[model samples]
Target: MNAWSNDGLWLAGIAAVAGLTASAASLGWLFSRNRYRAAVPDSSYPPEVLESLYHHSPIAFALIDRQGRFLDINRDPADMIGYGKHEVSGKPFLSLIAEDMQEAVRGLFLRALQGEQISQEIKVKHKQGHAIDLFIQTSPLIRRGRTIGILAFIQDFSERRRSLERIRYMAYYDDMTGLPNRQYFKKRLEEKLASARMRGSMLAVCYIDVDQFKLVNASFGRDFGDMLLLQIAERLSRSLSEPGDLARMEGDEFAACLDNLSSAEEAQERLQEILSVLKEPFELRGVPVHITVSIGVACSGGEDDAATLLKRADTALHRMKENGKNGYLQHSEDMDHVAMEKLTIQHEMRRALENKEFVLYYQPQYDLASGQIVGMEALIRWMHPERGMIFPGDFIPAAEESGLIAPLGEWVIEEACRQNKAWQDEGLLRIPVSVNLSFRQFTEKNLTSKISGILEKTGLHPRYLELEITESMTMDVERASQDLRELTEMGLHISIDDFGTGYSSFHYLKTLPIGRLKIDRSFVRDIKQDPSDAAIVAAIISMAHKLQMQVVAEGVETKDQVHFLRSHRCDEMQGYFGSPPLSSNSAHALLMEKVNRPALPAYH
Candidate 1:
């Protein structure tokens, strides 16, 4: 009974244990499958779903293990580096990372694998022998509640980076000449200023304005002008001899920074060398064009920063152009003060022109052979309320420089004609009045019409007006001929003033419809004392007579000079020797007085 019952119980117990073990094994298998499904969230993991996402993504992607080793990389990233898929798989991702970006990439990847998402733009080296920019995004790859790898999304942005760089270059560079433009110049200058300040060193700025560049631009086509500018830039950049040291400030204007200069003299020497080089004519589009530059130099010292330095240099350049083009001037504090004074004068002159603070003074012009008052020369005077009677020497230049000459000249014409008409009405002499014209006014395209308007407004007879221009301006033959012909047709007298000093072409002189030639005072002042002066005066008188142009000798200060001029049969004379320039009232009174031609010793 013991053997049969024990055997049955053992068999029954063993069978129950086997059934429980089988159920437990089935439950464990279901739980593992659910966890795996939850981690992947896809029914098909490595082959269909994940592989599809990796291969079909717009961006390149890499699958990396938690240990930072590449499991697989897609074709796009592989092609970006000129590589095949098999060449990069199973490789250490860190080895592929650029040396400069290695630590950053490593930290970001580590963070991503630790369940933190990351994105960054990184530079990477390509197997195609170039470096490229990449936008990369990394996120954790999880399996069963643990991150097993990093999912990296990468995009090649090298083309976009190149486009941005191109835009930046266009902003900073001159399109015509390939030089740095004003904005880039200022940026580089500021950076250099900081470096110079740190080193306690001096820097010099040069403002070079090509003289008469407008003429070149007009004469040559703009294409030729552009080519000329390129040539100029090449020459100028050669002088700079340093990368990023030269820039084109504007049209026909160039600026340069001279760093580490020791003194003003050093700057002067360097600038002088450049000037000499500039003097050489440039061959532009088959034409050898002569060019000159007026350079202004300002150095850093005494709180002068890049802006101030450039400003001072511009001021000096203005002074150079004013004094006369084709030269260089180093700026001093005194020059800056002078520039400020000139600026103030310019501003004040503009206000004065608007406010009618200007009046004309008439200087008597006498016939040389007969000292009878033949005409009156209208001289400008500024009756400044505070400054009191600023002469032409004081403000005429400033007016010319500031482009106030046009308006100022207009005022002079109208006022002079009005005053002359008033004098004639007041029983004064009825001789035609002469008014000086500036070159700027003469060159105005609307000059003839402007004068006509002034004459009509003032109701002055064209026969009673005489316009005077310097001989230098008459050298502009075509314009002078055009203007003079118009004036002559209007019945106004046109005279070439300050003749002989300007070496003018006689061919052009003959073309001008000039009625008279006023030999400049330079020769007249010394005519009696110097034989050369006498000869020149005689030659001018004879030549003028041959051309049917009357001669007026200026500055007959002494009786000897007057007699000498008379001996040469010169036509006109007016000077302190006759009477100094007078106020409007005195000039009117003088005009009222009628006198015979003063008797001069007859020369046989």
Candidate 2:
């Protein structure tokens, strides 16, 4: 015989004895593995085979009587509950389940005893009093359609459950600050925006940037910076009202959304409170540090979306930073227009560089005494195919903000050097050409080397390529002096542009290797009318001469202004009175005229 008979009492006896690992195929098969309708004593499998299956099966197996008492259990099931098979035998099946879950498990046991198969997740109790998550499948053991016992297959689920929880946390939370991260914040803001649109209620989104956060990180080390950020997050979270959500958007920046506001003013009031609270000092490792934030807020309107609202808030924040940080601003329609224009300019400037839409315009600088062109200053103009000629004022600020100044400045330098060499090669006068340098470009580590390479590539003498740096670039005199000395050592002329307008230190001026100072146009524009302006220009010229540096007056428009500068002994001047910035081709013709003049006055 190969199998047990399909009889109730005979099958129940085998199930209780063997703890069968396989799931029930039929009601009788669950209890005794019966398929052939043979007697139990005549089964083909040996007792040793059944014992090995019961002990070594990966899935936990348990057999319980109709009364819900443990009839027998396999080694896996016994180990899962921290018990020996003998200890569990004859005990109530609910004894191994968590106390709070036993009643629900009891209902499942009863259902299984009624010849139904079931699968469920449940919590079980281990011998050490910890809860273990488990998944179980139960089937009834029956004979002749009468239920006799329940057979269960069990598996541990705790590890997988923990993995899911960790994944959720990582997705929704910032591990460093314990605040919701950008992804979570953006999702939540979108939901709030939708709700506000439906209810016609007011909401505000605030974008915040920590002012001088880079300085903090640099001075205090990253560990202290991390601690400070945590403190800041905690304060921001606490200060925010119940109807609002705060999130860490990125390094040194946070985002918040306020809901259920009565009006835009109400949102502003709430945000102001948050700002006030953050003004308090934070202590890290027994040292106190004070920090301020700039905030930009946008209130919900009739049809605001998340992207538009965030962009408006971010734009407001940017303006606040520009106006000087440690303050907040609300978005206005005007700001949107300005932002869009700025964006368009930024986008076009990059394309302008790539497509050669940018061209150099040379404004001739003449010797005040000789009435002759001594040199020319190279200026950049963006000839946008669509917008026509765009002056530096309209696009230079955008370039500085977008970090396009580095490449833009490099191009101007190389082009000026190349043009000067081209003029000299054409048998024209070899006059030096000056190009203005942005402060950011002036501070570049490779500034000197970059200029040297340009001179070499253009085949222009270093002395014929003058670099103009503004006074603001000289605030860090030590560093500026180092770079300036390097350029001067390479035989390039160095001049300070808009000289007296910035915070200049006369003490450091003597030590720098500067050859010339360009008086700010602001002082010269009103010198003919404003007596103070005339005095300022005169003093500046005298100071330059005393320091053994030549002076050039900018914006010399009228003849009276020209005579004043010449009387002050200013070495050179450039303005519309001489010529406005001219295109390269026009400047080349002008230079040729100068070279061809029968008696060109000697250039100073």
Candidate 3:
């Protein structure tokens, strides 16, 4: 059938598939009238009997003359069109259908009058003035083998049409985010690709995955996670300026196809704009949390298929993850090699855990006033059997990408505590040992119990165990505050690391049970060259003291930095200026020599 043909079912409603050919009852009804009859009237029923049956029937019925005029509309049909029977007796049948469908209705009625009975679904303007889907059946009336008029029946199909529309909507849309689902997105992407090809225009495909999104869900809760996804979807949908579609592919993963780009740089600029927008903090359930998205982009090649383009984008996204996330990367042929290496690192890190190949190196923190070392922050080192020694910066990202951070973080805690106990047993200084915790560790439901178990197993006093978390960890103000309180009650100190580079408010910093703040190394690296760095460090020290919280200046490698921190009365300091991260034995040698070295170059 032609596209415009309405012969078959429209929405699978109750119409009984009835034929619209002239029926004997319809012929009798048309001929019941004496004046307008083209032939003899049926004696079985008078015009009054036919009128009563037609008016009382539930089905909306109308009679039209050969010219498609509404010769008569029964009470029910007239009510369907917001009119009295007397008001529409001579009006055209097209007046009842929607304005756009009036011409089509005229054509259909003309065909019926010419002996072509028609059954179809159409939309009509209802009595309440709203559009409604209706199943319409028209039968031609004949008397003395001459056609005079027709009988029309209409049944409401609005409810059935709505149900079918809802089903189709769910099939093509993401329920959590309301963006297009992956399957529907593929169709849209292909269409865009074809348009780009036709115009010889560039296209860019971006694959975005929230960095550690599962951790956000697990830590804050599933409810907040869903809310976060919804907000992200809404923002991303509005972010597109070019013709595109943003689709939710799976948990924490979304993709987009951008076409009609003048150049690849345009796509990059647009994508960076998206990252900037997400950098703004999201407030969910009265708690503000920061989120970062890692994006991988691929510009169209002279010839590229959807599979190839999408795979390239995904490969770039993996590269972003391996290269320390929270950044974007354009796809390149060389990235595939990096992707394979990441896979290898993931396998090796897991195996390294079983082989006990991971080691902890300690860096000493010293009191600025006394010139005496206070404690050591434990940093992980991977002594890969084949690659020799691998730093945390090299393999930690791969471990995180592979979902190995939970086990790796727990191991660090256990090992650091055990080593601290071992040092105390060897008649060394019993300074508190701090271990960095990843976002993943924060999400562990039994994190408190797990830490308690580690302390028990290592026989280390809780007073000597410290956990260092980034400022980002505390962005969820309520959750982070409660967690910090619990950890403090358990006798373990918590330090907010990388203090100035996150979205946490000062209120949380002053109110939470955080024991200390570590001035980020970036600010310290340029303390002498940049006056702003010195001022920031001074301000941080003053604020920490005002709150009765200790301050630790990290990466303080210069004597000038040391003098600056001492003048500012910073509480504690760590960097190469004191000493680099040392092996366990080296750290113990410094720990055993616990004497307060006086008359220092800066401290004195």
Candidate 4:
């Protein structure tokens, strides 16, 4: 029994040893797995390994002390500053910084030491005395819950900053002329105006518009036009080189701000200089193109703000253009009053067509050869309740400005056609009725449909409807050709009104489907005395005849004018000599008399 008990104890001891060995191996495996998990996580990177990965980072890294001294630096900093790490350690950080930035560097270091982070993009001088922009971020390096040093990560940002500056410049300046654009100029002008008001300094704003730019664009292509504008910008820049600011407002317009000028005389002289430069012909794409500029000057006394000053300048510029371009005009109280009057007139004119205040008067077109009425031009007369009769010369420009001419023109067409039909129904002489067409009306969409609708409503034939358009109307050849062709196809007669007043291009006469050319009153009124007028009138008649078109002379007021027109074989005469524009009833009565009685003497 004692030997068996001893054997059991020995077996128990061996089993205990084997259990201890297995427990030891299991603990070892668990410890290894825990270490691996802690080191790798899901990314399989340890803290030390991740930190060492950027040890060779290209960015300059430095440790700065609280006293603005370099404590330690990475290899990149050593290479960047042409110094070994050992050489730079314990040196004053400001020693390596540029002299201009030393105080800033010290302030940054102090801020970082006070537990505040510092970040700045600044230019620094390299070891070779070359400047480089650096993006610097300095953070406090805390150790054992106490701030010890600052870690600065610096990246070379010279190229990046330069690129950003380029983008900023492009945003603020015109790409073609390099002048400040409207947005930037507005901001600058606002700032200047505020300053000038505070400093009690005089400020002048000039608005400039290039005259005949459309002609330039038409004669030359857009590319050549752009070149011309560039040359003009150069000249303007040179001319306005005084202590002022110049900018390209838009298109062919420019704006300038003159601050602290001694007197208005100085401003005027500056304007004259700019004008002189602008008057010189610009050689664009090897073509010597001439352009004149009209300028409007507005001072700060009349206008307190930028927008008002700009508006005043624009008003003055418009007046200059109206008075014939290539001159300078200063804004005055009278101009403001005139502008307000125009605005009131425009507003009233808008309601004119809708209020049924518009009326048409008939001016008889006399055929000098037969001494009989051939046609009558429908002249617009506005019968304002308070103002009585307003002639076409007064409200026509207003209508054109307000863009009411299109709808007004449609009304005129309907009224003229109806009047002509009424005359025929009254047993009066039936003759073609001519109506003036504005440029906008002629180019309006669905013009053909509008005219057709008018004819159908009035029961008047299209052959008796003559549209009188100006020479400028045919300048847009492609669009005008299409419109004229469509009007001709619809059996309407087209006439070029005010023939010699505009830049008449004979090239268009051949292509235009025109029926007649009306010599402008400017030439006819002077034809008896002015040699130029006589020559122009004769040439126009000859040209009209060669193009197989009839010639009509407008504004013939005297016997001599009528004789001259008849001697020149003019096809028609419509003026005071024939009959002033009369009321519809009076015109109808006259037509009836013409049909019943014999024709009048040719001279009468």
Candidate 5:
């Protein structure tokens, strides 16, 4: 009975404790819910959230009056403007804006107060007198369903705007010369064209290229070349004081747009002045280095646009190069036709390789002393399917410009080798076959490999293959020397063609692995008539003999030319008089007959 009573008392005590715990838990829950609700203000909701319901509470906010005066400002607004609450309570918002933008600020505030939203780029002055570019958005502040003040959101955009301006300048200006570049030039040219069309004024475009600049760069190094170019830019800038635009089109090339030109002659005179100024020597690294320029001038016609004008200028520049460097040429209808023809030729040449439209003509080279054939030069001719035969003069330069010379050169080498091997197989004694290498081919990285591969494929001895490179082609001495060494090691013969035409540095010639020097046809053609030509030819032949190198006279068209070359002990001769370039079969027959014929009597 005692144990039962104790158990029942314990249970009753436990029940009483549980009932108190439940009441306490319920009160605590109610207190926490109320505390949470109180901690968060009703106005804590975002503007987007509050717009869905009517809620009001105190927070930092601003309200500008219709006249741009502060009707009501919160503590945050005063902090934002670096002012006390009372200081901005009734102050005009325009007072905080930059002086130059006060009227704009007033107008924006008025628009917002009139029930319109305003967004604008503006400047605001800080208490320190510094102006900040700002993006501001103002909305109407409504009370009792009537607009009374404005609420604005501001952001700083000074850095972003400045960055954009910098990018704009970079896009339109040449970083090196600080002049308007091609992009800016084109933009200005378009504007000028539009104005000129209305005013019936004329404009001219001139393209200028530094003559023999590659030679300077090759000889003096690129740093000196850059210095030279900078000097050129300065001189060019000084040369033009007229209202015109100048731009560096590319490396060692520049263009100018001359607006309000009265006539082509005036444009020509201006270009001449520019060219004359450019001709002056530039002091680079304390050394005065002279440079010449070629100018191409084009004037705007009724049908011309900016692109057409530039094209015309380019065409004129090409004509200047063709006519000989260091002069100016004006664009004409004839130039346009030539440009179109070149375009057509370039397009057709792309197909020439695929169509196998090229043929090899051999010009026999004679031993001047023996009057016997020693070798032949392989000349390329384009057998245009529809246009008949086209001389190299018509299309070789075009091929070079289009970067097709390398492949075309490979074709020439392979064909020449094959023909030479064929002649050898026909019991004709093997003779060296020389092929003129274009400047593009000589500079190609794969030149040696291409020649070696062709010789190996055709089973022709490398000694029987001679490469004739001009003096200008060897400007890159180190590279050319390396290439020449590699070629000579493979048993191929190398000769410097047109010896006196370019800046022939005898010092460099001695270093090259060369076997012969071919006097230029220009010197040899008039050797019999002009003492100057004779003297040059004689000097060249004499120099070649002293250097233990052979000399070949080209363009020996008359008996007198032949006699003079013989007197000079010239080693070989090739020209129209000996025989023009002949077909492959005829060349083979001639070679056989010459080798078999009795030697001519020595000149008495």
Candidate 6:
């Protein structure tokens, strides 16, 4: 028989395989009504060629009899269910479908028999009884103006379905710790919030921060840091009983949404238990390392939304850290006031930088032996137009948190260098101006280049500029050593500020090419009264002198404290005892007096 002539099966099969909207039933009616002389196109292939394509096509094709039994199926569709063409030729087509979906599949087949095209996704049973997803499209095969069979085009959909599942998993989960990410957590929080609101129940949201995790990351290596994070995640997972309630919000930070809470007190009790469990030391690389967390919790109120509740918890966390870490704090109204003040300050700092409202106040550093002003530290002050001068303590923490410190620090260095050069141009005695470097500025990449550019732009000699870094910057000793070495090579001076207040490792201290150490005010304030502070001051001064580094005592107010520092051979002192941080013009006047007078100022 000629496949492409008379029967019209070739057109039906081709249209079904090509997924065209033109069904064989409608086409057969059109041809019969028109009595088309060109029923088979002149360009139609030979009968054998059409038959070969029907059996060998990669696409799964099937012909079903009016009884819904498989009349003929291509190799691909047979292989889809682990069967061969000969084996399934006489079997009922619905037997290949999963039992639960067989009725739905039969309805669709009946609709196709009624001259309606059917397309749907259904699960079919393989030879091994496992389900395989398939996208099947069926069309009624019309012969001589009546339906004889159904043509189906089947496509394996299991791979695409599995791929979509993997994509969803990645989107909702943290790849490193395998916990819910911030987006997923937020979604869950919203769901829980809706449920709690409906039931007149309360829930709690918590924001947790790992104390000093950055220091640990710097001290150990990133690989070890990752291991520590994984351990922390596991511990948190074990602590929380509810699945999907806990999430890794960010680096060293986690959040939890606690539902089914009877009262805020219950949430607190549960958090306390978690804290107790965390008290046990974590074993990483066979070493027991102690870690602590600071958590902030906010219980849901009658009108709380997810974002508002989360912010409240974060505010509480900040309060916990401010009050000192290794503890937790409950969100209160007062904390919001504090958080608002901080936000206002941060906003003002941005404007202050843009408007040049931030000014440098110079505090004179006196040489203890020579009674002469040698250097001065640059202190930042916000000269608010209406509020007078706003101090560092009021705004610095906000700037640090808001990521405004890097640009502010750069401005400070540039302004200090420019002022120092201006003083030199006016014939004032040459004195190095020291600028404190914030942690963000110190750790930023290409810091040496930044400083070098500032010096070149201001036309100031590098020797007359000093950069002060805190002891925390030295926690990564090797990197610190290399960074400091680069600065020294450019002839810039380096000083360790607030030396005893941070990770004070004497062994790490000896490796850097630091020129000065400033003893913290806490020690110097009680140096004469407290024996331990006195001993610490004495040791710091002695050790600094031994290492050929100059010591500067901070906050030296009383004459007795200055006398003690002088007796200890402290190289310099800067505090109210000498003079409080001065304006640029005042500092220049004092320098001029030192150059003209035989005797220095009163305190000296």
Give the best candidate by lDDT.
6
Segments in model 5 whose C-alpha atoms lie over 4 Å from true places: 1-61, 71-87, 210-244, 248-252, 268-293, 321-328, 368-372, 474-482, 499-513, 522-543, 557-570, 589-595, 598-604
Per-residue C-alpha lDDT of model 1 across residues 373-428, encoded as one tens digit per residue: 88889999999999899999988878887899988888889989999888777766
Query: TM-score of every model?
Result: 0.82, 0.87, 0.58, 0.74, 0.78, 0.82
Candidates ranked by lDDT: 6, 2, 3, 4, 1, 5
For candidate 6, the lDDT comes to 0.84
Regions of candidate 2 where Cα sits further than 4 Å from its true position: 1-23, 30-49, 76-117, 125-130, 194-200, 284-287, 303-308, 595-604
Off by over 4 Å in 3: 1-297, 300-305, 316-330, 593-602
Model 5 per-residue lDDT at 581 = 96
Q: Write the per-residue lDDT of candidate 5 for residues 1-604, one digit (tens) a residue.
A: 2111222222222222233222322222222323324644546532334222211222233455566666543234433445676777677777878888888777777766666667689887766677777777665544335554555545556888899888997998877777778888888888888888889989888888999999888888998888788888888877776433788888998888877878877887787788788666788777888888888888887967888888889889989998998988888888888888988999998899899999999998887776777888999999999999999999988888888887898899999999999999998967889998988888778878888889989999999999999898787789889999999999999999888999899876788889999998999888878999889899999888888899998887888888888887889888997889999989977877876563343455
TM-score of 2: 0.87
> Which candidate number maximizes TM-score?
2
- Estimate candidate 6's RMSD in Å: 4.4
Clashes of 3: 0
lDDT of 3 at 511: 76
How do the residues 277-328 of candidate 4 rate in per-residue lDDT, one tens digit apiece?
A: 8766788667777789999999887338888899899999999999998899
Q: List model 6 lDDT by residue over 453-566, tens digit each.
A: 999999999999999999889988889999999999999999999989999988777899999999999999998889999999999999999999999999988889978888
Backbone Cα, N, C clashes tallied per candidate: 0, 1, 0, 0, 0, 0
**lDDT of all the models against the reference?**
0.78, 0.82, 0.80, 0.78, 0.77, 0.84
Model 4 ranges off by over 4 Å: 1-62, 67-92, 127-129, 135-137, 153-160, 190-201, 242-244, 347-357, 366-373, 383-389, 422-428, 441-458, 471-490, 494-604
Residue 556 in candidate 3, Cα distance off native in Å: 1.8
Q: Which ten residues in a row have the lowest lDDT in candidate 3?
A: 4-13
Instruction: Give residue 452's error in model 6 in angstroms.
Output: 5.1
Residue pairs clashing, model 4: none
